[model samples]
Target: MKNILIVGGSKGIGNAILLQQLEQNKVYNISRNAPEVTHDNLVHFSLNVLEDALPEIESIDTIIYCPGSINLKPINSLSIDDFRNDFEINVIGAVKVIQKYLATLKKGTNPSIVLFSTVAAKLGMPFHASIATAKAGVEGLVKSLGAELASAVRINAIAPTITDTTLAAGILRNDRMKENMVERHPMKGYLQATEVAGMADFLISDKAKSISGQVFEMDYGIVSFKI
Candidate 1:
């Protein structure tokens, strides 16, 4: 079984990935809060990726950085700190985790890394300036690191459209809003955490051994089609 380290695996898409991997791999979760479920193959580390020092693990085959922000607001209403905070959460934190575990990862079997972006980075949505800028940085990191770590390791990112998670609770808070969101997508639906989790699972597996430095958009056609 692979040894996987998932930063911010306490909730939402992260938690879904954590649960899915528990049956097959040993998972190390680092987040501010503990995950609600307990499993023999699971271990928890309580710390902030940006504020606290990450714990040491002897070996790790995959690193999945799941911390992100969705601070949507008009440019006039957004502050510099808003951009800073979002960048730190969406990009810097992933950098910190990857740097900390690079050595151990290099030594592991079929080592790979996965980071998250958002469709907002490419879709040009209103009120998404801060997050779009930040997730754009994430995409850059994936491309650069995919080349830098070419032989030693592999890296990629997932860019999902508005997922039904607490992070997006503000947007999908009402039935009317939810319907609007569904209608916005050509697929007529938004994403479930499980579907994103499945993509994460594929990126880190031997099945994706040939893939790296790419951003997979789970956008439900929002970014891919006009219909």
Candidate 2:
């Protein structure tokens, strides 16, 4: 079984990926809080990716960085620190985890890395300036590192539209809000963590061995179509 390290795997899409991978692979989860479930193949690390030092693991075949921010606000209401905090969470944290585990990852079987982005980075949406800018940086990193790590390791990013998670609780707080969100997407629905997790599973598996440095949009047609 492959040894997978998932940063911020305690909640939302990260937690969903953690649960699914445990059925087949050994999963190492690092997040501020512990996961709700446990299994023989699961390992949990409690710490902040930005404020705390990451734990060491000897073998890691796949690394999935899932920490992100949803700091939505009008440009006039946004502060410089808003941009800085979002960038640090969405981009710098991923960089830290990758750099820390680069050596061990290089020695593993079919080593690969996955990072999370957002459709806001591609679809021009109001009140998304901070997060969009940050996730955009993540896309750039995926492209550059996909080339730099070519032949040694593979890297990619997933850009999902508004997902049904606590991170988006503010937007989908009520039935009317939820209905509006569904109507906004051409698919007439938003994303579930499981669907995004499935994509993450594919991107890290041998099935996608030939893919790297790409951003797959799980936007449910929000970014892909006008209708």
Candidate 3:
């Protein structure tokens, strides 16, 4: 069994991943809030990735940074603080966690790091400037750090389109809104939180050992097709 450290594992994709892996892996859930469910193999730690320091972990086989922000606004309407906040949560927070646990991760068995990105980073979407900018930086981190730690660890990211989660409740509230979202993607379905979490699970598993520095676009064809 491996030891996994997931920042922002309290809810949404992170929470789903925590639940899926806790049965076999020793998982640490660090976030401002604790997970809704608890297990023997699951440990909870309160943390604010943008503000607080992480607790020392013994050995981390996989590192998943899940803290993200969605401040969708036109470029002209968005203030500098909005960009700063997004960067702090989506980029700097992940950097802090990775830097803090780099030593422990290097000591693990085929260690890997998983980060979350957004399809908007690749596909141009109106009112997505803040999140897209932040996630773009995350993609860069995966590429640069993946190379820097190639011998010691693997790092990758998942860029999913609008997913069904509390964080996205505002966007998927009514059938009209949901339909509009589904219509945007060639695949006429919403991206589930579990599906994204499953990919994260795979990256950390031995099956994906050969993969690194890659950004998996789980965007349901948003970046590929116009239909």
Which window of 10 residues has the lowest lDDT sum in candidate 3?
A: 47-56
All candidates: CA RMSD (Å): 0.6, 0.7, 0.8
Give the TM-score ranking, best first: 1, 2, 3
- Taking all chains together, each candidate's TM-score versus the true structure is 0.99, 0.98, 0.98
Model 2 reaches what TM-score against the true structure?
A: 0.98
Candidate 3 lDDT tens digits, 44-112? 998677777779889789999998988988899999999999999999998988999999999999999
Candidate 2 regions exceeding 4 Å error are: none
* Candidate 3 error regions (>4 Å): none
Q: On residues 57-112, what C-alpha lDDT tens digit does candidate 2 reach at each position?
A: 99999999999988888999999999999999989999999999999999999999
Give the Cα lDDT of each candidate. Answer: 0.94, 0.95, 0.91
Relative to the unseen true structure, what is the C-alpha lDDT of residue 127 in candidate 2, on a scale of 0 to 100?
Answer: 94
